[model samples]
Target: MRRRDLLLLIGATAGATAMYQAMTRLGFAAESPYRGPITLEGDPKGASVIILGAGLAGMTAAYELARAGYKVQILEYNTRPGGRNWTIRGGDTYTELGGAAQQCLFDDGLYLNPGPWRIPYHHHAILDYCRRFGVALEPFIQLNHNAYLHATEAFGGRPQRIREIKADFEGAIAELLAKATRKGALDEAVSKEDQEILLEALRAQGGLDKDFRYKAGDDAADFRGYARDPGGGLAAAPSNGEPIGLHDLLTSRLWRGLQNFALYDFQTTMFQPVGGMGRIGEAFARQIPKVIRYGAKVTAIQQDDHGVAVVFEDLHGGGSVEEATADWCVCALPLSILSQIDVNVSAPMKAAIDAVPYASVVKTGLQFRRRFWEEDEQIFGGISYTNLPIRQISYPSTGFNAAGKGVLLGGYTWGGPNSYELTAMSPADRIKVALDCGAQIHPQYASEFETGISVAWHRVPFTLGCAGEWTDETRRQHYGNLCQIDGRIVLAGEHASYIPAWQEGAILSALDAITRLHKRILASR
Candidate 1:
């Protein structure tokens, strides 16, 4: 099998943790490259910079440039800051590309982050900024043992606990390995001493009995949970549940869900802002309040050897055309929207802008009358994987065991036919689909659902799609030209960095772009 196929097989059979380990050995997964906060060492001699968009990248560039003594101003299309770093709460209204306006009717304190939800610990730059800006963060639960893994064809379509699948799979594998070792099947491959050590390790890791058997007993119950709970009074002894046979377990294919939590990105210690992901953008905006010009849509980007001029329509001022000039420009607009604008840049740069495509994504936030997932299922904060079109349902990481009214990320569909299918529907129909699909995992979805909202990235007005989607061939052909400083105008955003589709990518790209721009400016003098 090919390496990719091998990894997929491991993920299907063993689990995602094993697959990640194999991938790490094969150089597929890596940590972030952010070192620390950047320092612009030299002055720009009072040079000015024009930053486009009010997203993290634009705001990051503005924040650092203004502190470095450059006169920095940002032109934003939206009335407020945080382009994709947005949050929708009650009383807010959103109009998509097709003029489909949805008013958020969520209860107060219940909101949805339509983009860039979790921040990995390895993403040092964003975390450092959050700390500096006083944006409190809470743990984002990626996996809960009590959460479910559901396959339509598995176990008669009943959901199984993540812990059950994980434990049973591990235990069964250990038993087979032990049987092989006892039969001297590894005599040529392993020394007797090493085999003994391996057996002991497997016994401990798999919660096996002394005979190396993975059967129903205290050892098995310790891992898979007891059939009957141990109480304080008579008949307090816990009863071990019957372990699923290896044949049945393999056929069920529930092990595929194990990969979701084992991937490097979804590992433990992920975090989200206390209020919403939008808090980070709001915090960045707080640092550079006067620098942003809201409701200004850029129509053309023109540049000369002397400076750069950006022509925009004053959205709030009767749509009148206006021009803003600066010594330099940082265009942080998403490529989906930028490719449609008239930009005066080199052929390579323009081609690079048009080369990248945006991903299709749909996220639906459903508010419930009660926290039924917690009250009835004992599932706190975690994700439930399914084979349904909705993909996965993520429970709120905040508000553990709270009383009434909670919001759930009912459905999040990333790329593929499902995302496009959901994108084609009206927002109301999308919500209905979410309710229908999610009900298979949580039956309470229909009754408990109060009101919901959905955001299809393709329909979003400001960003025609989600983050830039770059393929290997596209990156190899155009990534350099995309990041190269085109005269006085340069691009910065998640698309400009290796780590696309992440806020960290946007921050890192902005820092790198500004650092390079600062060097070129000082050299020019």
Candidate 2:
């Protein structure tokens, strides 16, 4: 049987609790940011809560609220859980705002996570939930030494290996600093004792030779890698790769991509769910299946001191308008969609809703005939950065070396005119752009392409656009209003957190919202 069918069979056969226990036994769980289970301390006296959107934030709140003795009911716009935490697999279909539908045609077990993909190790809340739900985790390689970095105008448009550029750049900087320090250029900035320590550190860190020079030699080759790799036999001597000169390396502008690898969030040891990021949502759904009302497009939100009432349309049932009311509400809807709704909040809150704008992102997933990136280019996993419109190409971290076929993130267009340009095109055209732009970095895309699916977040009906884009000025003026509970209702999601566009932001925002809401419940009683 295919892996997809096997996964389905397992899901059908196993209960949520049993599946979690099984995953625990298999060592699928990891250390988490959140401690153990949350304790609400006191009873809610059977309070009722109406949650908006069944995304991570909303579901997270519902899970904790239900456990704390609150009557929780969730209003979700989509037929499935995991709003932006979505995965596209073979046989799945997606329809955008322009009535353009794309059917995924990837092979069994292959998928495209059009939304959030990588999970940083520090995102404690989401990790804790994954541990609790038994969602399996696997390393998401963010910076692979073998990945490519290409600038369309540099090095004749040929790609350079990450290891080569990183090593060369470090070596060049070390040499420059050493030369300056020896010449007394930094006499005022450094003391004699510290200068000696700095020189020693640079020599070791930059892989410099006995003379502290980053030249083509065995020591240099060990760090940046070799032109001819060392083998196991007597004839296995390695040849050194020359360090890229300071001028050429600076002019190439390839060094700009290196900073992302050093970022606190994108650093090594990132993770993804075993199947897909949506497994987190699916697991959350299992805990509270009966509470969610799918296909409920909330049209208006009105809250009085007594309670909150939401007006919505049943999209699945002939678009009949209906109302749901609860003692309190947690609105996790995206600002892109919520801003248009007739929400009767305070003037400051309304302005805050309108103040933020959502970002535009287009992601395309391409299936290839085989794992040519691994076989041909030796790029097993990680992202390749380029100056092209596609921005970056990510190879799958799973199924390395032993693959009949594979899917890669062909293009992940985030913001700017390029994102808008791609968003305007049809789904097929978007895929074509991805193929054309990606060819500049990996020529194999021209021959090995099989099928593709593209998602332009601006054109997605459910989200209208990607996560909320906050500028310093906008956040200064509106962020407080957005997060503060407006009367009997509060808001939570990635938009409400500092770590925007991340699942951790959404989970953490939910936790904060519920904690405050619980306090209000106790104070009111």
Candidate 3:
């Protein structure tokens, strides 16, 4: 099915779509018992594994480690687990507060915003997990999210019509895409990730038409056409265990075969979980056997002959010094937070994580007594590309008995007046900043909430920012350097994976760390 139709089917389901997509693509239809837990239970003590965070990555590693028969304990600083895939609820529905962002765009609009922002069934890890779990799949959706470019300079609350900047915007992007398919290769089966990445590289270097806009327009379809590449839904290469590089396969054809769709928003799309994205996290948590040490901030990790000693602080109360000695440890804390961990790792590991550049994103949730957007005459939910302080907003709480209107209005806010100053602001001030800036997106934003809380990861004690990666080669190498030193200190986080900042990355990295730890545990015997 087209990505848009898939989205509609998903949104129609409410919020359970993400997990469904993950499962379906991975081929999980009936591979395992859907209602039961699949664990890796090994023996304790022989290879006690201490997981440093309860985020997806940490928890994933824990589940895999546990089923392997290793005693596992997960330590986290948050009062709750799920790390970035956090969910906040009002009525019956809960919206992801941290990492997972949902959308309302449709099939062809997979690359569009407020939906499948850019999930192509290309990542082997995402597909594999989905199949292993038995979740179903759906495509994307397309509502009013048809946008080609977006101007950060401020247009208005609603997205500008495509006719507004036809010349400099759509014209250039269309011409550019045509050039990719024209390159001569890509006709044969190749990994989508490599193809898109190569095309993007060429597009950026002026390989195509250079008549591009200095700034993106409301219709990000033009610029992000290159950005909305579905992940090369692919399997790992036999030789390297990495997805096959497009450079290896499609290098001969170039971009001569691609096509551009009409609904072109650059935002992420996702089928509204029949329930919510939160369901996916809950699923993983249920499957995993873990004791999350909430509010227990890891301070240090020291390694020696026997194993590793993890030093931590119980941030929930009076400070106390506690240490857990484990045969191995997996550090699944955020890279930003990891940098703050009191223990000093090797200089290279520290430098690598420290060097990753994180984009500051503000996620603010506004609770409304009713569903204002649903009442609006313009369209249904799946609001995208608004010219406001908020990047995108969807009525996430549309269907729920307890939530009343059950409205979830959220946005991705970046760079604006006092954007930098937010770091020093108080909670009240930050909320005001989000609300004040948010007001530009919709007046309801300024005056809507009875009361709301804005969780700025930038201001979060340990987490500094959102999904961005390091460009420096040295920094990238640092991620690999951080592993269990002889099965004692493992590192797992968004930063630890090739695809950093995404939920899939967190789980994938954890799996890697867990696999290694599991091997060590078994080998020791």
Each candidate's number of clashing pairs is 0, 1, 90
Each prediction's TM-score versus the true structure: 0.94, 0.93, 0.61
What is the C-alpha lDDT profile of model 3 across 1-525, one tens digit per residue? 966566556654556667567547755442321222334445555467788877778877877777767777888877766666654443222223344332321111111111112233334454455556544434433333322223344332233322223322333444445454446455464356666665655555422334332234323333333222335458432221111123322332212211122322223343333333444555666777446777887888887767788888878777787887777778887767777666556676777657666656665555555545445423344444444455545444234233244344455556554444554455456556656654554466544565444545565444666654666675446656764443366678777775666666677677767766666666677
Best by TM-score: 1
| lDDT tens digits by residue: candidate 2, 272-383 | 9988888989999999869999999999999998999999999999999999999999999999999999999999999999988999999999999999999998988899
Q: Best by lDDT, which number?
A: 1
Candidate 1 regions exceeding 4 Å error are 1-31
Runs off by more than 4 Å, candidate 3: 1-45, 91-143, 146-269, 272-276, 342-345, 386-388, 395-410, 415-418, 427-449, 483-487, 520-525
> After best superposition, candidate 2 residue 294: deviation in angstroms?
0.4
The model with the greater lDDT, 2 or 3, is 2
Clashes of 2: 1
Total residue pair clashes for candidate 3:
90
User: What overall lDDT goes with each candidate model?
Assistant: 0.93, 0.91, 0.53
